[model samples]
Target: MKYTVKGTQEEGVQACAKHFIGNEQETQRSNVIYPDGTEVAAISSNIDDRTLHELYLPPFADAVKAGVATVMCGYNRLNQTYTCQNSKLLNGILKEELGFLGYVVSDFYATHDGVPAIEAGLDMNMPGPWDSMTAAMTYLGGNNASLWGQNLTTSVGNGSLSEERLDDMIRRIMTPYFHLGQNEGFPSVDPSGYFITAVTAGYIQTSRGAPPARDVRGDHAKLIRRIGAEATVLLKNVNSTLPLKTPLSIGVFGNDAGLPADGMYVLGDDPPYPGVPRSGYEMGTLSVGGGSGSGRSTYVVSPLNALMARAKNFGGRVQYILDNALIAKGDFSTLYPTPEVCLVFLKTWCGEGTDRASFENDWNSTLVVERVASHCPNTVVVTHSAGVNTMPWAENENVTAILAAHYPGQESGNSIVDVLFGDINPSGRLPYTIPRREADYALPITNMTGDQSRNASAWQSDFTEGLYIDYRHFDAMNITPLYDFGYGLSYTTFEIVGTPSADLLQKELPPFPPSSQVEPGGIPGSGMKCSKSRLSSVTQDQSPAQLLCSST
Candidate 1:
């Protein structure tokens, strides 16, 4: 509703359906399909119809048809090519096919996504004063308008942006500007008046997105809760430390306990809550680099609250430790002279699609596990975070258990309790590799750059691993992630028929059902099975083996 109609008509703002083809969830937002919405867990693939119609492409189609005034270009590359500037999306489809006459906008700082966006037929590269080649061109003479024209004219001549391209883009924009009477603001007079109805010949456009049946703003919390519930997962349990079957005393630490709590969403408290740092510096600023709202986006849920909530359900009381003073120290003796299950909630946030600076949990997280192991024997770590991390904590034979709850939203506190108390199965997966450390990245390419092709690392960002960003790279390098991508655990086990056939792997997952589609769930972490199974290695350019299976 917001993207297609509410933001536009209700606010009188030109609603731009962003990321033309498919861009969502910045953690590895481009050139991938999270299938199940996990970024590190994405697979290299094209936009399938289920997504094209349901999730991926529809908004733009709707925008164009409904007479939306603009669309935004994506910052990341799609299929190894920049989308801000992909011609297939811009001139070919948005124009000739969809018949859109409105303008196109590049995402803030997406001038990189811009050149291709202009070639693709995007009209405005915004959050702009153009830079890079676009800036250089602007200095040369052509502003974005002329720079775009020059590039298109050149692309057509040299086969970069394309020639027939210039005319098609020009024609499309001109048609709306002139034929639509846009010369006089399309003669609608009032953007919200009766004139538009009379002039367009039809009030209901084929392209508009339908408004929600009701005001969902009231249920925003409910919606976020459901997403939290479904997305959370129990990753490990060495001795079955979860389901809090019996009532007992609890020991809690970290931000949840509050000696002096991190302001959270407020960013600058003890243990330090996350702040939106601009692209330029770590000092707090309103915007991150590229001048867009930082997606950290202000969400908070403390583990202590969740623990207390769960304990109440089972009839138990909880104690909080104040001050970093080792209430338990390396030993749980301070919290419990007698034994009780220790629960450590590790809250780690790596901006989406971006990998962590290190693969292991911080010393605090490890120390929590260390104390639990020394004193409480029965310990479980409920990690509330986004992305995956190699568990150095797992090294302790006594650590006992783990859970991967990817940024569960508002009701997150309550949801963790439900699952721990046996309400839900942790069915989530590690979206990317939990490599041992930064040095172990066979090519260490996940979330290395926020840019599409800017070279920043000592090792060149390798495209030799093209279309093979996730587990495929792992398989190729024969280097397994500490935790493999797509690794998820369920309360009940799922089995896939081991019918091995290479040819069969090429076939698509059974087409998405009418109501929903395949999110491409499962990776080697889930369990590895290949199509040509008798035993064989792969060569470069040859696809890292694929397996076709049936859930048995």
Candidate 2:
């Protein structure tokens, strides 16, 4: 979050730290799902003060410290009260406790009441004038009267919402503009140089006879491919089953391997209405998440075809059999049984507007793999998901290997093949822990029927686990996860050298010289960079320094 804030603002664009606190789950965003499966419009979040400060607020604190320009509050209520109207969070915690000086903005249509949110230190309500025809249908209803724009003036007139508070909000909003050189007598800067279509009026219109423009696509193609390769992690390689030997016959399964890759935040261009052609690039395979972060490119390489070509180039034969119906039924007998090696591709799509119904795998995925693993002992599973997912079948005896190719973009297939054929060594690390079971997570209860049976107004979530989230919870409970955080595998092996013993570290160390006193090649240098070729030199180096190296 800090790097994102610094990187964006350094480029002259303001970065907004979003969903202020306790938005870990996306359930009940636009509506509430009752215990009986009935749905109604609502949203809520309930977190204790300690949990809020320790687990949730740290990232935002880092963002503020990094000079984030804006903070957008989420739509959910905090502790039974809507976030936009929660003074303790926006004013007491974010402003006073964290020392945030930036403006506070509300999520779209998130402001349920204007006066309370203003009093709570919310500086802006988005998509306004607050009097738009579309916003009126939702805000002007009897269920919510406080959100109407007139309420702000009425509250100020009644002395319920002070004018001083309103003025402070204005100051917060205008401060950024003032720093951006938007003051009086300052000439407004034109943005014609920034946008592609602005400089060339007919640039976007191919029919207007303007030749196709050059882009960075051709130049950065290798970088994108390398990124995909670097991000593909080899989670399990028991018995060294990967980088298949030549003179082999391979069988590939799963629709994901053949599907065109997609996973963009937003489409390059989207028509306001149907039947209108999108002006931007064509989306070949839609892999992106829905809602806010969704965009598609013109083309993507199929992992299946890429593997087939690679295998053929290596003098090996390949066969692809896609069985959606049988896989759903937990039967793998329909697939060819003669191949020496079998590879399966698994995918889970998630983005905006909805959450996965459960952390457990759907029947079509892990369950099918379990069945296939039993049938084909040489099978290797490659998983593609937007985030961490349950992996019960990970320990199956028949499964030779498991590769986590997390939502690799357009070149996903090429990257997978690069790692699989030993062209590129896998070096990616797991960002979060994967639990063996769904119940192992901090928030076990979700959109299940009986979970939210009580009232229609909100659902209560107690952070009874406190600061024990993810690996911390696992460590505290002494429970083994499917894969611990920072756990990963590689084709090659490595070992550290010249490391002090645990007993030596337990003893107090002598006073060390400051970095300023040490020369670049001094005995007690700040750090050392080691290479695979320097393995034999490990015992010879006795310098008090930390060594860094990447094994791939």
Candidate 3:
């Protein structure tokens, strides 16, 4: 939060802390009524006060204390009231207890009632006037009415809302602009070509003629490549199979090794039915997940492209088969032909609108890996996924290595090759526990009850698991995970050589510091400071840490 606020505001851009409270699930996330007269109420996260404070509220509090310019209330209800208009959450906890000075904004079309929303301390209703139908057909275009523009004026005229409260809202909204020094020379707003392209498919032109083409990409590719390489977790390397030595013959398999055959810009495809080939959208090298959060790349270098380039440089033979069916059906002797190494790329498709039905990879990715590994002696499997993927073939003897290359952006191919060929050491760690079974999770995604064909009205998700989630749940229940969180591998190793020691300083910590005037970055100098009082000795022959500690 501090980094984002400081960085963005330094460039005259206000940072927004979003989905403010409990918004755990994506199912039934918005208020909408189907054409068949079925109305779906946003799921209410029924969190107890203690659990709310301990688990969900602290992150938001930290964001507020960082002096975030804006906070976007979520789509879900908090204890049965819509978060956009929840009085206790917005006014009581956020503004009063936390002492947040920024304005509260609602998620896109999340606000239901105008009066209740403002009275509950909602300062902004995003995208103005929007109904359920308009929200549902957002891409296709529909009604565009302001929910608060006239309604707010009318409310204040009738004395339903006080003028002072209206002024307070304006003051809150404008405070960040001046606080961030946006009144000084900031870059002029340009027509968003990306947005125009998405909505109108390049059919609509901006009123200012053509959107000015500017290349703001300043060494971002280099940073992205470095991050990608560093984040590639080496899950398995039985015989030091990775850091490839420019083998004479290499065979690459699976759709994930190349770009999607159909196209690159497809978004949001239905999960393929049994026996149907997975759509190009799902099968291709998944640099990013689907839905709103996904970004468009200027160009993507596929694993095939990167490997071919590398092989060309080394005068090596490169062969690849991107079709999943061909790999499943082909004879190993004819297809692979005694290749020195076989690389299998696989991915799981996950995004914003829905939850994954299972932990297994889509389109029988495991079967592909198992099939290839069975034929080839030196098979390396690379997986691109958003989260925990059940690797049934982790124990397979034929599989020599495994790389969890989670959703690396445009530099996906180069990054993987860098790690594979020993150009960069893999140090990425798993952020989530890989459970042996889907049932091992503390809670399964709540399914719609009452009817299968229509949306359910009583769509309430109970937080019965409390704080026992992810690795915490596994620890509490004594359920051994397939791969525990923070599990990662490196080409080299290190050993702790000495006992850690810390300088002792005893002082009674106060419950609260003396109250002060709240600034944009919260109370000045309130952020916790870390002193270099602890030390530990470590030994490593050749590692990143050794380079840093060499001078010491």
Candidate 4:
């Protein structure tokens, strides 16, 4: 990929990794959310050994480790931190820690955090979305980007940037752009040449591979099935009554139930495919997958649209509401309209770059489920999200199932519906834990703060739970999550029973005792969600809720 960057530089085009440090999902990202180190330990706290090393920081680390000429900062904060201005993230981590040589780029309309960012070490702002940049510059009164301009002038005058640190920063930033010929000589155009279609098969071969269905699309389709399968997490299965066999009339519905891949958010470049919707925008202008820190796009793939297309194999059974109205406000009864082994397609959207506060913004879906559960006793809920969200209707007995597809990429829509309808069994687990309530945030106060940030050591003492991170401490400590880590459901039940076998393999998962869970009141469902409201925002402020499990 760095080679591609070098090639882009050769062509003299600005190549940007918009929104650095993985700020992909979450609406109203501008408003910060100080995730308690306790709640978002996967990405926030230094827990989960694997996540700490590979999952969360590896990509950026790899890019910089490979020398991505430039990086864009994001709008949201990470674990009570604004990613843009946190110098620890910027100078300390990216440059100093990971040895990043490139300059920092800010996302559209994300410059509001510029002052702190500059102090921390951000270098550029773009498109001037709000166009308040000029005003900001003047307001700087020579206090640019935490004195970026002033710092440079001072540093150069005093010979700081000339020093090794500044020299390194300069090389990182200028190389790629310079290679693009923006900063230097004519970038290597030989690497930037497109096959001119006629110039290729006219210039190259029959543009196909792998024999039989050798088209590139076929290979990609195969890969999507694999990745999407791994990314599909099974949320819950109560009585172990899952992995359903025998052909059953499983109702399918959702804003995304019937659609094909649009590849709108595919990282870097993924071209249009046969049967895929063509974007109204030019291919060059079509920004697929990257952080909002990259830029904005007028296109997206509707899960309903893809679900409809993918469900064609099931025939007349796959019914769509077609009303085109998002059930953002009304109940499913009002919108879903029909009722057979139902799958309600709930589509949520507040805007281009933002978030919806509650897990359920309205009683709409729950109300819909309440109404439809009687109509079709079997129902499953599937969610497509960019980040972890609060699930308001999680405990409804009528709601039989749930699956979380985190922006499952291009083929997500089709893959999700397939899993829910039994075409596939979900195996993916939550990448991060799902908190029961919005207020469960480790630090609710962080998001409200403006651009200025002072608490560098805040997370050290502030993470709420000192060491209970991710599933390790939390689950072991009896901290009940809305959904536990490693929580995934499948259609079939396979009990892991054993009598102390000596030979164990990876596939042979170790068995645990089939302990009976005795509920305190001696009643089955009384205390399950009864204590839900007990975790209100007010309560969260005064005291973090302890997981209280009692014997029946």
> In terms of TM-score, which candidate is strongest?
3
Each prediction's Cα lDDT score? 0.50, 0.65, 0.76, 0.48
Best by lDDT: 3
List the candidate numbers ranked by TM-score, top first. 3, 2, 1, 4
lDDT, candidate 1, residue 414?
62
Q: Per-residue alpha-carbon lDDT of model 2 for 153-268, expressed as tens digits? A: 78889999888987887788877766654464654444332233322222233334434433437755577677777777788887889866763678777656675423332333
lDDT of 1 by residue, 289-405 (tens): 122222232444445666776777777778655332354366344554443666665555344334345555433556656665666566676665545555776657666667777
Report the CA-based lDDT of candidate 3 relative to the real structure.
Answer: 0.76
Question: 352-405 in candidate 3: lDDT tens per residue?
Answer: 656777788776787788788877889999998888888888889989999999
Q: Which candidate, 1 or 2, has the higher lDDT?
A: 2
lDDT of 4: 0.48
TM of each candidate vs. truth: 0.57, 0.71, 0.83, 0.52
Candidate 4, residue 236: lDDT = 64
Q: Which run of 10 residues does model 2 get worst, by summed lDDT?
A: 528-537
lDDT of 2 at 496: 44
Which stretches of model 4 miss by more than 4 angstroms? 1-94, 97-166, 174-226, 237-316, 320-340, 350-355, 361-363, 390-397, 421-424, 435-477, 491-552
* Model 1 TM-score on a 0 to 1 scale: 0.57
